[model samples]
Target: MAGFIALLPLLASANAAAAEPGPLPAGWVAAWSAAAQAVPPAQDAPSFNRAPDTAGRTVRQVIYPTLSGASARIRLSNVFGNAPVTLRSLTLGLAGRESEVVPGTLKPLTFGGKTEVTIPAGSAVWSDAVAVPVQAGRPLALSFVAPTNAIATTWHKLASQVSYVSGPGDFSSDTQGAAFRGHITSYVWLDGLAVDAPGASAVVAIGDSITDGMRSTLNANRRWPDRFAALVSSSPAGARTAVVNVGISGNRLLNDSPCYGKALKTRFSADALDQPGVRDVIMLIGVNDINFGWMPPHSGLDCDVPHVRVQAADLIAGYQQMITSAHQRHLRIFGATVTPASLPADREAIRTEVNTWIRTSHAFDGVIDFDAALRDPGTPTRLLPRYDSGDHVHPSDAGYQRMAEAAFEVWSAPRAR
Candidate 1:
């Protein structure tokens, strides 16, 4: 994920609320999701040019759902664009090697009974439900074609999943991926995949890059949330539970970034609460807010613009706000202690103070001590060597598994319900 923000004068506010989702459809749950961020404009930075051009191109993306259903729907976003985007065609099917779709599984998708859709700028829409069998842990491919000159201005910048783009034409119905000549590592336009699973509920894992699975193996689905979903499915009582991730890399609890999307405090409602069938949330944030203030500022794109230093009380207040909001929605919220990230004495003190409250205050319905699960016994302030993802900040695959285990122990306990 780009750790820096863009230089543009904060164009259109990507944080503007989309139209109210109204009443959620009954018996439907979010199977997968990626928080949407406005693509940084092309400046001198190479990181700003990551968004793929979608004009008249067929983009196929692979997504894995944690629940099964006989019908499904998709959510698309144009929230950061200045122009309307028209999808001339869209299709879904079981995925095969690379970008290929399994034969006989491909089906067309429509919006409001129409074969195409035009999303207005700064808005998003959910497609009409399509009768398609969805399986848990199975990969599904979603392909769409933009017939007009449409650039991907809004997207999940660090999908950690490989998506394919076809040469200039509509290949939404093709069973083969030969037309798909290029590959991208981000998800464009698409933000969510939902399935009609009665009685099934979801757990949203929200936070910063750690939850976003940054530095995890690409296309491997080894994110801690992904591992947690697997554990949920294997347990006898967890068959009906789903987990969706809305973590934006470099996200903060109290502040927003041009590249990292909105602050957790500001975007929680849209990214987590608004998700269909959401019944629980597990949040791990504040580390960035504590560390970003110390990053040296550069000339062009200063992502940490405000760089406001925070204290334990400041972060505690943020946590209180989230806990209240989750309870107001009648959902159980779990707090996660920030994992070890080798830091200076001052920052480490802030992290320790914040984690102490998360552990002792009982502010949340439950607590997941990720810091304890991954920290070195000999060096409590650093991640265990095996857990460190080479960088002291993020976790390796084994480290992510430990995190999932910690969450599963708390989430699966009889009292947690």
Candidate 2:
């Protein structure tokens, strides 16, 4: 009864292809299903092509990236739109490279097309599971002759975690077969994927914009989450846990609906919590609250204010609630201490209090001190000067690397996950 919300599995069918999911450990339970978060439309500035209800953006010749080694039975997102949307006149092909031609493959994707998908204005709908082999480091282009009438291009990258191309890469135009010639960054949905991923173990990164890896090199896809995933998947440290980022820019643990999160991509509960094989969650958000935007110090004071800031009790409660939610699924929830904030003294104080609370709280299964890793040795609460990403709020590429290293050192340890 206590704040319970039952999530129905993404609409799937018997014919949908599924991967042979590896077994869980002794104490593990499959609470959430593995599915990519986005049902993206067109990709531009990470925008969702939107129209009004009863309309959809029919991507002409689109290619979407798939989660590696995944099955074909997957869902799609129409999450960001002003109304219900539909994807039709479809053809599916294999991806060649960064951006190029779509390669014709033996495989193809389909749906109950006659029954158009009605993505509620505010929510997305998953397609009936289809069989598609998601290649590691490869993308699947979904081609169609139609267009969504009311197109609110979605944040395809947010969920799919793959890049799209205007044309196929490393392949010839003929390989694409039809109508696909140009190759720019792509934003389309691919099938043969699922949520509650088929993970041996999963890593859930929880945090703010930094963790969101905003402003990182575009199309380079070098966010620490991707790096961490690569690191965890290879060589000495390779553990079977899947890595999923649940960081919402400017998000606060206590503020479920913070203002910074209002404008950008966020699927916190569904992307991080509801993901399958997610045994661990690493939170790394907060900063804009402290920096307080251009108008430094509200009310003419020397400091800014976070109207939605979740101070002490609120933070504690938020952490406890998140952990409790994870526990119900028998998931192990790890608390990551807030990283250093590059704000003035008062803001730093608030961050320090929050970090301290995170460290001392018994509510988490474990605690990760990212603060210690990214802080300047000289100034414990400020992002290392060299790592600062211009704004003094975010991290540079090196800073992100430091952030990644710090987080990995803690969460990637044998003892933690």
Candidate 2, residues 1-417: lDDT per residue as tens digits? Answer: 333322223334321222112232232322212222222223221223221121222233233322344344334454444665555444444655433334446243445433234444545444433345555345454443223355433432333233322232222223433333333232333222342344355577766667767666655646667666666656355444456555645454433331233321234566666554556776655455434443434332121234544345555555676777778878777777767766667767777887888788667777767778668899786778877776666677777776666666766577764
Where model 1 places Cα greater than 4 Å from the true spot, the runs are 1-21, 47-49
Backbone clash numbers for all candidates listed: 0, 61
List, residue by residue over 12-33, the lDDT tens digit for candidate 1: 2331122223445799899999
Worst 10 residues of 1 by lDDT: 11-20
Query: Model 2 segments beyond 4 Å from truth?
Result: 1-67, 80-82, 90-93, 112-122, 128-131, 140-148, 153-199, 235-239, 256-267, 289-306
For candidate 1, the TM-score is 0.94
lDDT of 2 at 91: 42
